[model samples]
Target: MTDPETFIRSTTRMLPVPGVPEIAVYTADEATALWEKTEEQLGQTGLPPPFWAFPWAGGQALARYILAHPQIVQGRTVLDLAAGSGLVAIAAAKAGAAAVWANDIDPFARTAIAVNAAANGVAVGLLPGDIVGTAGTWDVVLAGDISYERDMATRLTGWLESLARDGAEVLVGDPGRSYLARDRLELVASYDVPVPRALEDADSKRSSVWRFRAA
Candidate 1:
């Protein structure tokens, strides 16, 4: 298998995120093609899609909100969970976060985050594993587009709730994914986030940012 960075550079183009023009990340031209290409490159089958190659709607929305409202993360330590492409993590750093960590379970995603963060001229620490059930001292925790699956969403929400209770401000950005725990969150902001037609049902997703309520 080729070095992940080399494969990512060959397969994607650095592009500015929609709505958030201050930052850019490596993005694939098409999701399905990239998914297949990733598998072929790794000599693997049934691998997850290359999600780190695109700026998802929820991430874009969250990035826009953070850039617009820099006060949210300014001078605070932040963690971007499932930090695909490091989009939101870059936003936090650009918004003046004291320190930012981009956390993702995928090794490919960790490499992609490092690449994208360097491209965007921000220093971000890459956390390469599942830290969901663990406690951290981040002043702010950001999650984007994470509620797409039933069981995963349930587990994540539980962890996020615990984070909130521990005094970390937890925020979520989502496009009405079926499992989003609205009952445990309060709306902070909303936007019509631009999305790739190949990846979403529509060209734009009405995404919302929510603050997890400590329960």
Candidate 2:
């Protein structure tokens, strides 16, 4: 595979998201043209679509909440699981977290996280592979939009529950996806997030930030 960092820098532009103007990210301008440039590099018709190339609604909602309530992460060790675009991790750093780690399995996403964190003037550490079952060492663990899949939500929620049991605060942001088991979570905040028409069917989504309650 080609270097994803180089591909991302060339294909995307740094733009401020519509609602979350405080942070700027390297992302696609339009849905149709998002990954078109990568086609030639892969020499194939379909390459894995880059999730890091856009600011997802769930992540945005979580990030916005964190910024608004800096006390949640201030002076603590924080982790942003499935840290797409490093939005929440950057927000944690900006909110005064002593240290922040952005975890994602995708190499391109990791590079994007590094770039996005730097662009936002925040330094974020990287956890480049899946750390699902591993015990978390941070004070707070944040996940956004990772529960869209059945198996993923099952696996991740189980692990997140464990982290919460160990006394680390676990928070998730989701737009009421099918996989999120709401009964196990406590709603902490809600936002009407504006999403791009191409990404979401609606102009805005009622997204919620949930805290993993005591088991």
Candidate 3:
């Protein structure tokens, strides 16, 4: 068997995007088990828990949106919540956000964010902990693929609503998850994302991006 650490390090290297200038993203695919091993290695330092790495479809949609509409983030302070691989955060920085904060519960995720940011040649502030304690308001709050579970969806939606009430723009990207609250969300854009066979009910599934505004 391949050494898990080496496998993860090799698989997660910088990825280039076609036709997107100064834009690239890090993705965790089937080899995510290797990433888990990296997290174990990080445990020796007594740092925060490593954020779980997933397919990152939500982040991809958010990144595509930012690239298509650069004006949304230009000169604004942005927050990327549950930023798994820092794809949304990196996109915001590249789109000219004045500053970008990438928050996640996983320490390994924070490290990956740092590496991806540097690879993309943008600066991102890594917030390694729950989002509750993070201070300061932002012009925009971006989230991706966070509504898989009902309880988590409810709590996250509540928090996003709170941020919206405070005048912060809250946007979420999802692939039509069952737990998503359709009533409170608006369809900003949709894409036919390629869902891996392992993640989909069938061979592949197409996902959509839904944006939520405070109601």
Candidate 4:
């Protein structure tokens, strides 16, 4: 496999995140070209797309909300669950979170998060492996753009609800994804987040930050 750091650095460019310009991240200009390059480098077909290469609409909205309402994470331990590119985690750190942990199952995401956190001058702890069922003591738990798949959404909804019941402030950012359990969450904030046409059907998405309610 190609070195993830080297591939990212060579294939992507550091750019300010749209809708959340306070922080910048490595981003790919063209989705199809990057996807093809990634497959070629990894010598695999049908690989998952590089989610870390772009700030999704939901992540942009979440980061914007966290920066605007720093008190939510200020002096608290935070977990950016399934963090893509560590956008939300970096935002939490920038907003004064005592500690920030960015968890993702993807190895490339881990490398991207590390590179992004350093570029933004923030210290974000990168946690690898699956973290969904693990018990956590973080004061706030954040998830962004994770409801795109049905099975994943179902599993995470229950987990997030459990976290909320355990007294963690569980929050999710979504752009009305079909699988999102909206009935189980309370809306905290919403924003018109700019998104790339290559990844989304529209130029912008009406994304919302939601607080998961305890079951």
- Who is ahead in TM-score, 1 or 4? 1
Q: Indicate which candidate wins on lDDT.
A: 4
Candidate 4 lDDT, tens digit per residue, 1-215?
66999999999999999899999999999988998998999888998889999999889999999999999999999999989889999999999999999999989899999999999999999889998888989999999999999999999888889999999999899999999998899999999988999889789999999999876
Quick one: ranking by TM-score, best first? 1, 4, 2, 3
Superior by lDDT: candidate 2 or candidate 3: 2
Which runs in model 1 stand beyond 4 Å of their true positions?
Answer: none
lDDT for each candidate structure? 0.93, 0.88, 0.70, 0.94
| Residue-by-residue lDDT tens digits, candidate 2, 41-154 | 666677656778888888989999999999999999999999978989998999999999999987778999999999999999999788999977999999999888898899
Residue 54 of model 4 has an lDDT of 93
- The lDDT ranking, best first, is 4, 1, 2, 3
Clashes of 3: 3
Leading candidate by TM-score: 1
The TM-score, computed over Cα atoms with residue i paired to residue i, of candidate 1 is 0.98
Q: List the residue pairs that clash in candidate 4.
A: none
lDDT of 2 at 208: 87
Off by over 4 Å in 2: 36-40, 43-48
Question: What's the lDDT for candidate 4?
Answer: 0.94
Between the candidate structures 1 and 4, which one is better when assessed by lDDT?
4
| lDDT, candidate 1, 1-215, per-residue tens | 89999999999999999868889899999999899988998888999878899999999999999999999999999999999899999999999999999999988999999999999899999888889999789999999999999998999999999999999999999999999999999999999988999888789999999999876
